[model samples]
Target chain A: MTLHIVSKSPYSSSALADCLRTCGNGDAIVLIEDGVYAAQTGSEKLQDFAGKAVFCLRADAEARGVAVTATVDEIDEARWVALCTEYRPIVSWFK
Target chain B: MKFTLVVYGAPHASEGAASALRFARALLEAGHSLYRVFFYGDGVHNGSALAAPPQDEQDLLGQWQRLQQAHNLDLVVCIAAAQRRGLLSESEASRLEKSAANLATGFTLAGLGQLAEAAAVCERVVTFGG
Candidate 1:
């Protein structure tokens, strides 16, 4: 499975949306840097990621003062590395 | 294991390129074989031969060139992205009627298919940039 990492904000670019379109069911999406904005409550961007596995970097979320929902898994640096090991073809979407 | 790196950020302007460079170095140090390093989007700027940074600052373009030479690495810049950013090779400059080409040494312009092929064959593909 591919691990799609989106580090750009949904507001600023279509990186997240573009990632969702190509990512498969088994693929995972991890939000980092400005991408933590998409994990905020009531974000329309969250709706697009409804059924897929979504994750947010814990450091990024805390830095942005955003709360991580139950639906989104908050991962640390070690967990991020673990995810990379578990998955292949780690794709990063940014613009 | 064979690995591929896809970079999407410009050098110096963003941390992406630096991070990728460090990671690539570490990967090699750890005995991992790199299949390719694909530059896409703004990452194409990393291949500009005209970039002249302050003498005191790190020359990221030069660093990449040295790394490519030392490792015998395949450094590919996406043709579509490179063209969009006005980074041209000798042939591309001739074809487009541009005055000169500024693509840095050790980097070649290719299609996105190269990325696809790398992803398909490499054991892992890591991306750096946002």
Candidate 2:
């Protein structure tokens, strides 16, 4: 499965939406930088990706003051690297 | 696993450089081998030798150089991108009749073929800066 990394904000860019559209059911999405805003609670931006895994860089979320919900796994940089090792065809969606 | 990093953000201006640096270190700490770091677009600014950030803030360019020294990291700045952004190496500066070269010590000005080759060979190509 591909690892889709989205680093743009859902509010400012379509990066997450575009990535989600191209993502397969087995693909995973990791939100970093401003993209971590999507993992926050009460955001309709991430209503998609029902079956796919979603993750947020914990440091970024905390830095941006985004309270990430349980729907997304808050991971550190090491786990993110581990994810890169476990996955293939890593795709980055940024504008 | 082998990995390549594609950095598209400028240092100090965008979070891409800092984010990519942290990720690079994490990748190395996890015992993964980094094949190359291809800096394209504004990310080429990370290779500027004259970037004098304040003593307080993070010195991203210096950090990248130190990382390169530690791991012999291949920091490839795109030729087209660097030229457009006025980031030239010593050879390119002299060849193009420029005044001085500002490309950092460890960063190499290369073509996009390096990125393509990295994508073909590396197990993963993680990108930063949007």
Candidate 3:
């Protein structure tokens, strides 16, 4: 099974970075909640994973009034469910 | 299939804990079995016995207890992290001669080996943090 990571924590950024370092070129990184902040458009850290599918929550983005500039797709609750069902990813919710 | 949840955030500091709780409920409702819930790093604070939120706020400890009892969940608090944060069980508290043990019931102290075991046994190990 492909491990799905919702990189949402600032603390786990290093760990997330560590995780992505081993990306087999088929994994995805969904930046939800506070994780959207990590995708500051042209951030070098986020650049590596841009080739993979990157997602952010639309509600969270609007709440923060920050436009996600990365190659990030938007996900709502229904879409979230769909992704989970389709991928059955091992979700890592980072704060 | 079996899954293990690693909670890495405090109960109130962020939504990580609440989200994890919600996901656990969803997983159970969807007919999935949980092997364990490992509390690591700042996540151990969620199991502290001294936390007292406002009256309206969800009693996190109570919620964890309820889920644990109902699901017979194996809750493990990382001993290294707990000690660093001053969270101890009754025995550890007494052995260390601390004022008290803040670890709640339905949870036990364990090491990183538990994490490795979870990784090996469970089909997926989900982590909630930040």
- Who wins the lDDT comparison? 2
Query: Which prediction has more favorable TM-score, 1 or 2?
Result: 2
Can you give the TM-score per candidate against the true fold? 0.66, 0.96, 0.73
Lowest lDDT block of 10, candidate 2 chain A: A43-52
Structural RMSD, model 1 = 4.9
Ranked by DockQ, top first: 2, 3, 1
Model 2, chain B only, scores a TM-score of 0.98
Q: What are the root-mean-square deviations of the candidates from the true structure over C-alphas? A: 4.9, 1.2, 4.3
Candidate 1 segments whose C-alpha is farther than 4 A from its true place: A1-83, A89-95
Ordered by lDDT, highest first, the candidates read 2, 1, 3
Model 3 chain B: worst 10 consecutive residues (lDDT sum): B14-23
TM-score of chain A of each: 0.96, 0.96, 0.74
The TM-score obtained for chain B of candidate 3 when compared with the true chain B? 0.96
* B1-130 per-residue lDDT for model 3 (tens digits): 5778888888888777776776677777777788999999899988887888999988888888899999899999999999999999999999999987888888899999999999889876777875
Model 2 CA deviation exceeding 4 Å by range: none
Q: Quote the lDDT for B115 in model 1.
A: 100
Q: Clash number for every model?
A: 1, 0, 9
The DockQ of predicted model 1 stands at 0.31
For candidate 2, what's the RMSD? Answer: 1.2
